[model samples]
Every structure is written in structure tokens, then in C-alpha cells.
Target: MAYMSGNPSNVSFVGAFLNTLGDRLFSAFNVAVEANGRMARVEALQALSDEQLAAKGLRREDIARHVFSDIFDV
Candidate 1:
């Protein structure tokens, strides 16, 4: 008679599932944080006058694009 052990396989499956879940949760968190940061940046830039913005080398029209360029690859 032969006995088969299933403990190792079960543990491996649980570990893989947990790892994937953790990765997805982390990715979602990062996306939320990035969006919040981008919105804040846009608002702050919008509060600046044209002269002040130009002093910082930024244009009002490009605020959103500038803030989100990292994610958009633009």
C-alpha cells in the first residue's frame, strides 16, 4: 500500500495565491496614490499665476500632462 502526501502541494498553492493577491493589492494602492498626487499637482499649479508658472518653466495648459507623464509615458 502506498500513501500520498498532499501537504506540500497545498502549501505551495496557498503561497502562490497569497503572493498574487498581495501584488494586485499593492498595484491598486499605487495607482490610487499616483492619481491623488497628480490631481494635487494640477491644483497647485493651477493656483499659480502665469508669471510664477513661467518662472518655474511650466505652462497652465500642460499641468495635467506634466503631472501624469510618468504613467502615460509622455
Candidate 2:
């Protein structure tokens, strides 16, 4: 009795896994780009004067937290 049976199910499973992996990789890349954008925003904001930042309702100390506000609960 041959214990190994070539089946289409196995191929489908592999394909599905690869697709999921690719999606996850793309999502991660997008998140990285978004984070970088947030960092840049924070840097630009920091370069502004305190009065300017206050006008925008932002504080120097809150820059990082503000940038990641959408990503984190804080």
C-alpha cells in the first residue's frame, strides 16, 4: 500500500498559504511606510516654534505619541 497519495488539496493549501504570506508582507510594508511618514510629520512639527505648534494644538513632548496615535491606544 502506497502511503503517499498526490492530491490537489495539498496544492491548494500551499497556494493559499503563499497568498496569505504575500498579503501579510504587503501589509507590513505599508505599515512601515506609514510609520515613516508619521515620523517625518513629527520631525517637521518639532522644527516649528512653540507658538506655531500650539496653534496646531500640538506640543513638543507629544510628538511621538501623536504620530502613533492611530496605531496605539495612547
The Cα error of candidate 2 at residue 62, in Å, is: 1.4
Q: Scored by CA lDDT, what does every candidate get?
A: 0.89, 0.89
Q: Model 1 — which ten-residue stretch has the worst lDDT?
A: 65-74
Give the per-residue lDDT digits (tens) of candidate 1, residues 3-51: 8677888989999999999999999999898889878989999999999
* Off by more than 4 A, model 1: 1-7
User: Residue by residue across 1-74, what tens digits does model 2's lDDT show?
Assistant: 65756787998999999999999999999989987988899889889999998998988898888888878888
- Enumerate residue pairs that collide in model 1: none
Per-residue lDDT, model 2, residue 26, is 100
Model 1 has an lDDT value of 0.89
